[model samples]
Target chain A: MPGSTLLHIDGVEKRFGGFVAVDGLSLEVKAGEFFALLGPSGCGKTTLLRMLAGFETPDCGRILLDGTDIAGVLPHRRPVNMMFQSYALFPHLNVSDNIAFGLKRAGMARDEIATRVAEMIALGRLEGLERRKPNQLSGGQQQRVALARALALRPRLLLLDEPLGALDKKLRDSTQRELMDLQRRLGTSFIIVTHDQDEAMTMADRIGVMNHGRLVQVATPRQLYEQPASRWVAEFVGDVNIFEGRIERREDQRLVIACHNTGAIVAAAPRQSLAGEAVCVAIRPEKMKLSRQGPAEAAIQAGAINRLEGTVSNLGYLGDISSYGIALDAGATLRVSVTNTARVDVDDFRPGERVVVWFEPDDCVVLDP
Target chain B: MSTRQLFTRPARRAAIAPYLWMVLFFLLPFAFVAKIALSQSALAQPPYLPTFDLTAGWEALKAAAATLSLDNFRLIFSDELYANSYLRSLLVAATSTTLLLLLGYPVAYAIARLPERWQPIAMVLVIIPFWTSFLIRVYAWINILQHDGLLNQVLMALHVISAPLVWLSTDSAMYIGIIYSYLPFMILPLYASLAKLQPSLLEAAQDLGASPAKSFWLVTFPLSLPGVGAGVLLCFIPIVGEFVIPDLLAGSGDMMIGQTLWLEFFANKDWPLAAAIAVMLLGILLVPLLVYEHIQRRQLEGKQ
Candidate 1:
C-alpha cells in the first residue's frame, strides 16, 4: 500500500462463537477519498466500520492508519472519529459544549477550546443556539451538533455509520449534500456505512458492496452500475434483465449467446469466458429501447440489434421516465425504460400491447452463470 | 346527565383510586403522627382524647423546646461520647453508600452490557441476596467479621495479618454489615437505568474522540444520575434511622438516633421526652425527604 493510504484494513475477520460476522475483509482508503461500505443488513458493512473505529478488534488482521498498524489501538487513542447513526448527541450538553467536548478531552487551553468550538458552531450554522441542550434541538440540528463534535478533533479519518439514516427524506437529502461538501472542504477521508444504494451512489467517490461477510465488488457507482462484476452485483446495483445462456459464438470483442429460457440469440460484450459454457447476459432497463416496429438493418450487420417480441405487462410513470415491463414470448419479463420527452402520450402505453425490445451488443454485459 | 356523562363518572373514579390509595396508606400515617406531635403528651397516651386547649399544648411545646437550656438537646449533642457516636454512625453510613456505589456501578454496567440472553440471569443474581433475611445476612457478616472469623483466619494464613485483629464491635464491621444489607437496593435501580441507556451514546462518545474513562464520566455517569440519586436516597434515609446494625456490630459504642429513641422509650420510660425526641428525629428525617421530593419533582418537570 502507498504511504498516502489513510486506512489499510488487511485480512480483517470477526467471529462470534460459531458464526463469522466479518470474514477476511481487506480494503484501502486513500487520504481524501469519500469511501462507502454499501450493503444490505447483516452483510458486515457496519461490522467493518466498527473495526475501523476501534470499537471492534478484528479476529485475524492488521488495521493500518497513516502507515502505522493500529490493530491494538483503542478507539480513543486512534486519530479517527465516528458519527453514529442515531446522531448520538449528548442530551446533557448544549451544542457548543458538545462540540467542545473532544477538545476539552485533548486538554487544550480554555481560550483555544472556546475559539474552536465557536468556529465549529458557526461551521455547522448553529450560531445562536449554543446553550440549548441536545433534547431541545431538532433532529437536523442535533445531527449538525454531532457532526461538529466529530469534526472538532480534526481527525485523520472520519467514520460515519449511517449518518443520514435518522433524518426525514428531505433532511436526509440535503444533509447528504452538505456532508459531501464538508468532506470536500476539509479534504478529510470519510468511510460511510449504509444500506441505501441511493445514499451510496449520491455521496461516495468509491463504493464497496458487501454480501454475507464478503466484499463482492468495489468500484465507482457508475462502474458498478454499468459493468457489474458478477450475477449478484448485476442484480443488486439496479434494475437489470438477466437471461441465463451459453455462448454460441465468439467474435473480436463480442459473443453470441443463446439464452436458455428465451431460446434467442443475443450479442453481448465478451468479458468473461463462456464459449460452450453457461453464462448470464445482463442489460440495464434504460439501455433497452422499445419500438413499435423492428429495426431496418436487423440481420445484415455483425452483432446486429437483437429483437424480442413481447406484450407490455406493467407500465410505471415516474415523471421524467416511463418504465414498461414487457412479458416476452419466452415467458421471461424484460424491463425497458423510455424518457418522457415533450409530454408525449406514448407514456400511456397499456398492458397487452405488442412491442419489440431491442438493445445494442455493447449495452449487454456477459458474466458467468 | 347524558349517557356519556354517566359513563365518565366510573372512568374518573377508577382513575382516582390509585391517588386515594396513596393518600390513605402514606399521607394518613403522617397525618396521625403530626396530630400526635401537636397534642399534649398525657392526651397522646392510650384512651387518648385530644383536647383543643391551646394552653396545655403550648406548655408541652415550650417544655420540649431547647432554649438557653441545652438540657434535652445537650442530652444527645453536648456529650462528646454521644456526639462522637452520632458522627461515627453518619460516617459509617456515608462510607458504605460510597463503597456500594463504587462496587455496584461496574456490576450494573456489566449487567447492562450483557447480551439479552444473559441479562435476566445477571439481574437474578444481583437480586438473589435479597431473598434471604436481612437480619440473617447481618448476622452472617458478624460471623465473617469476628476476631477468629473467616476473614482474619484467611488473612493470617496468607500472612497478610500477624494476629487475629479485633474486627467485630468496630466501625469497619458496622460499615460491612450496612453495605451487605443494602447492596441490592443500590444495584437493581442502577442496573435498570443503565440498561436503558442507548449503546449508541457510548459509540458516539468514542467517535467524538473521548477515551473510555472520559466517556463514562462525561456521558454514562451523568446519564445514570437519576438511578444513583434513587439508590443513595434509598440507602441513606433508611440507614440514618438504622439501629439494628450498630446494636449488633458495635455493642454500646455505636449508638445512633434509632437506638437513642429505643432507649428513651423503653429503658428510660420517659414518655414525654421520648415523644419529644421522636418528634425531633421526625423533623430531621422529614427535611431530607422534602428536599428529595422537591428535586425529584423538578426533574420530572424538566423531563416534561
Candidate 2:
C-alpha cells in the first residue's frame, strides 16, 4: 500500500579511503512510507542514511528527492533532516526553543515560530515541560525533543539513525507506535536505520535488508519474514531450520529435493531454481506440527504434508506454546512448536519420545544457500 | 560502637579535612593580614603597632584593638596614586585577558578537534613553553622587544618598518608579556571543556537546517561558556596582581596594584597601607573566584 516513489537513490557509492562502507547501492522510498534499512552493525546502512541526509557526499551516482537530483547539496540546504542516535538535543535550548530552532533558521516570524513551536510541543506531547533544558529532561523526553526539532522544518524525508536506540524496551515499543502514527499524520517518507530486526519489522512498512555494503533484499515485513530472498536474510529475520539439499526432480509446481541431512523433502520450488540446483529448504519452527504417535491426525499421510520422523531431543515450555527440538534419524535437528491449548494435556510429549514433524509443502521456503 | 558508626567516623573526618586545610592556611592568613591592615605604621621591630599578642590575654588584646584604626584604608581611598593604580590594574587585566581569549580560543579549538592520537601531543606543545623559567621568559621577551631586538631587526630587514620602533618599556609590551604568560591558563581550561563537547550536538544542529557557522553560534559557542568563564577568571585574576610583567616590561607610568603594593611595602615603608591594599585586592578577586567555582560545580553536577 505504498504510494509513488519520493526519494530515489541511484547507484550510490561511498568509500572512506580504501574501505568501501557503501557499495554501489540503489533504492527507492515511496512517499509517506516508513521504510527501514535493516542490517547488522557495519553493514553500510548508516552510510546510506548519511548520504540521503546530505551529511556524506556520495562518491558516485545521484540521489533524487521528488525528482530533483540533490548532488553537491549541503546538509543545511537540503530539505532533509536526521534524528541522531544520541538524541542530540541542544543542551542550551529548552524544549520549545529546540523545536523552534529550524523554524527560526528559516527566518520565520516570531509569532509564527511561537505557533509552530506550540504545535510541535503538542504533537510531541511536551506541554508542561517547554522551558526545561534537554539535560533536565529524561532520556525519552530528549528523544521527543530531537524528533520535534527535526520535524519542525517539515522536510520531505526524515532520516532516523537508531531512533529508539536510547529508549528502554517499554518506551521503545510505545515510541515505535507513536513514530508510525506520526509518519502517517505528517505524510513524510521516513527512512529509519536500525540493527534491531524486531524494531524494523514492527515499525517499517517495507524493509531493505543490507549485508556487506549491499542490499540483499527489499520487501514488505511479512514478505521478508515468510519469503526471504537468501539464506542470510532467512536466518537474520527469524529462527529457521535450513535443510541443505540438491533438487532431484522438478514437477509442475513442486520440487523434490534429496536433502543431505533431512533426507528427501518435497517443497514448492523457487521461481528460478532448476533440477540438480543446490539450495536450502527453510522451514520456520512454528509452521511444523509435532506428534508422538503415528500421525495423530490423518493429514500426515495425505500427499500434501511433508513428514519427517525424529526423536524429541529437547523440550521448552514457554507458557503459550511448547517448542520441541527433534533430532531426525537422518542426522538433522528440526524445531517444532505446538500451541498450549490447555494447562495440561494427556498426550504431551517429552524428551526421547519418537515424533513426526509435519508441514505443508508450501510452508517450506527455497532460498539460495 | 557499631561498624557503620566506626566507618562513618573516619569518613566524616576525611570529608572535613579540606575545610580544615582551607581555614588553617587561607582564612587564618587573611585574618592576620586584616589585623595588620587595621594597625598603625610605626618604627618598631614589626614596623606596625597594635599587634595581637595571645600571651598578653584579653585585656591586652582589648587595649591593642582600641589603638587600631582604618586610617590606612581611608588614605588608600583618598590618595590619587593608589586609586589610579587600582584602575590601571583592572584595565590591564581586562585588556590582556581579552587578548588571551582571542589568541587562545582558536588554538584550543584546533587542539580539541585534532585526531584523538594527536590530541595529547598538541596539548603538550601548548604547555612546553612553561618548561622554561617564567622570569627568564619575561627577560627573554624584554630582550626581543628592545630597540635593537630580534623583532625590530627582523621587521626592519623585511622592510615592514623603516626604523627600530620603541617596543620596550611600554604599556603594549606589558600587555604582550601578560597575555603570553597567562595563555596556557586560558587554553588549558578551554581545551578541557571543548574536548568534552559532544560533536553530535553540532551535527544535529546542522541536520536541523543550520549551517556550520550558524551551528557554532547556536550550539558550540553556548556550550563552551563554562570553559570561557574558567579561562577568563584564570587569566584575569592573576594578571590583576601581576607585578613582574609590568615591572620589567612597562614604564613607571603603568603602575598596577601589585607594583603599588610592592613600592608601599619596601620603598615607602608603609606595611599597614600595603596590607590594606593586599586585603582589598583579595576582596576584589574573591568574587570571580567564587563564580568560577560555582560554574565548575554546576558542570560536575550536570555530568552526574
Candidate 3:
C-alpha cells in the first residue's frame, strides 16, 4: 500500500480441494529490498511464491505487483520471474539459448536477443560455456544459467524458490554472497523462499518466518534473533533455552519471571503479553556463559539473572566456537556456546564436569507459553 | 569396473548365441529358399527333382524372366492402378500415424500427470486393448463406420445427417482401421517418455515468461520428439507391410504391396519370381531400417 512497496499480497489463500496450503496470507515486499520467506517443508512458503509468480492463483485473495492487481494475469504476462528450486534449465537448450528463451518467446529481434544473451552470459560469468547443455555443466554453472534466464527478462520483481538448496555448503556460502551482491547491483525487489534459517539471515534484508500457512514474524535478522514475537519464532530461528515460568512482577518496560526448575527469578521485557501471567523465558544458547565459579554479584543484582548448576554432558567443536551441553539438576539440558579465542588447554571442557551457566537479565526473552 | 564385468559376460554369450540362432533360423531358411528357387519341378514325384541341375534352374529362371521379367516391377511403376494403390496406402498409413500421434499425445500426457494411485489404472486402460483380437477391433470399426452402422444411425437420429454415409470400402475406412489397430503401439512408448518428463522444466518455462502454448512448442514438444519418432516408427513400419486391413476394408479394389506379394506366391505358382519380389520388398524395408539405426546411433552419440 505504501509507495516503497513493489509487490503486495492481500489475504492470499490457496487450497487444493480440502487441504489449505496457504491461508489468508498478506505481506508486501518493498522495492530494491531482498525479502525472504523462511519456513520448513509444507509451511506454504513455496505456495506463496508460486502465487506471486502466477503459477498458482490464490483461491481467495489478490496479488498485486507495482500497484496493479494481477489475479487474472497469466504467468507470461506478469512482470515477474521465478528461479525454481531445481534450477530447471532447459536440458535441450544450451546456456545462451536458455538465457535467451524469454526474449525469443517475446519475438524480439535477433540482434537484440543475441546482445542481451551475451550480456547475461557475461554477467553470469558463463562465457565460453554458451554451447554446453545443462547436463554438461556443473551444478553451480547450471544454477547460474537458471538465474540468468530468470533475470534476462528484467522483471519488476523476482521470486526465487529455494534458490541455493541444491548446492553444497561451501558453494552455497559463496553463491549466497554472489546472489546478494547481484540483488544489490540490480536493485530489483526479490522475494526468496527458503527453509534454511542461516541463508535467510545472511542474504535477506528482512526475513518473514512462516509456520502453518501463517507469517510468524517479519523483521530484520538481528531483530528476529533478539526479539522474536512468539515461542514458535524463538525456537524456529535459532537454538534457544526455553524455561517454563510464571511472571512474578510487572514493570513498565520489563517483567520478572519466576522459573520453576531453577527457582530463579528472571527479568524479560514482554513484547505482547502482560506481566504477572504464565510465560516462557527464551534465552539464546550463545548468550549464556559457562564458568567454574558462580555468577558475579552484578548479574544477580539485576533482579533475576537465573543461575544454574549442571554437568557438562557433551562438547561440540565448531572451529571458532565450542558448544557445551550442560545437563541441569532439574533434568533439563542447557546449551552454552563459548568463543574459541586462543589455544587454551582449559577450553576443552570434558563431560561430567560440574559447571555454572548464567546469562544476563536482558539476554532472556519473555514469551507467551 | 562393474560395467566392464557386466558387458564382458553378456558379450561373450551374445556373440556366440545370436550367430548360432541366425545360422539355424535365418541362413538355413534362406539356403532352402535358394534351393527351391533353383530346383526343377517333376510331374511324377510331387514337384521334386532327383538331383539339382543348375542349368535347368537357370533356364527356368531365364524363361520366367522372359515371361514375368521386370514386367511385375514395371507394371507396379507404370500402371496407374498400381501407382494409385501404392500412393493411397502411403497416404493412409501416414495420415493414420499422424492421427495416432495427435490422439496419443494427450492420453500420454494425462497418464503422465495422473496421481500415483491412478497411474497404474491409466496404464492398464492404455494396454487393455492389447488383450483383445486386433481383427475384432478392426471389424468393430466396420460396424461403426458402415452404411446404416452405429455411427450413422446415431447421427441420423440426432438429425446430424439426413442419410447414411458410405464409410466402408474406402481409404478413410482403411485409415481408421490402421489407426485403431496401431494406437496402443503409439501410446505406450509416448506414455513412457512423457511420464519421465520433469515438471520443473515446464515451471521454468513459465517462470521465464513463455506462455503455456509457447512453452509446449518450444520445450515440451522438442523434448518429446524421441517418443514421437518411436511411435511413428512403431506404427509406420508394420503398416507398410500390412495386408489384412486393405483386404478387409479395400476389398481387392486397393491392392498394396503385401497383397501383390501374396498373389505372386499363391496365384502365379512362380516361386523364383515370388522370391525376387520378396527380395525387392526386403530391400525396400531394410534401407529404412538401416537409416533409422544410423539416426538412433547419432542421437545416442550426441547425448554422450
Best by lDDT: 2
DockQ of each: 0.51, 0.62, 0.59
TM-score of each: 0.86, 0.94, 0.88
Mark the 10 consecutive residues where model 1 chain A has the least summed lDDT.
Answer: A267-276
B78-161: candidate 2 lDDT, tens digit per residue: 989988998899999999999999999999999999999999999999999989999999999999999999989999999999
Best by the TM-score measure: 2
- In order of DockQ, best first, we have 2, 3, 1
Evaluated on chain B only, candidate 2 has a TM-score of 0.93
lDDT of 3 by residue, B1-304 (tens): 3546757776877768888999999888976655544443334333423344467877776654443234445544565754565556566667788899999899888888899799989889878988888888877888898887998899999999898888888877887788778888998888888887888899788777777888888888888887888898888778876888887876556677777667756685655545545555555667667877898897766566
lDDT of 3 at B70: 43
lDDT of 2 at A53: 78
Model 3: fnat (fraction of native contacts): 0.76
Local accuracy of candidate 1 as per-residue lDDT tens digits, A1-369: 223788888999998788788999899899899999998899988988888888888899999987799988888778899888888888877788889888988889999999999889888999998988888788899899888898999987888989988889999999999999999999989999999999999999999999989999999999999989888998988899999987777777667788976665566556555444788888999998888886766452544778888899999889899999899997788889988886645546679988888778878888887
Off by over 4 Å in 1: A1-4, A272-276, A297-303, A342-347, B1-18, B43-92, B113-119, B141-170, B266-279, B294-304
| Model 2 chain A: lowest-lDDT 10 consecutive positions | A293-302
Query: What TM-score does candidate 1 get on C-alpha atoms?
Result: 0.86
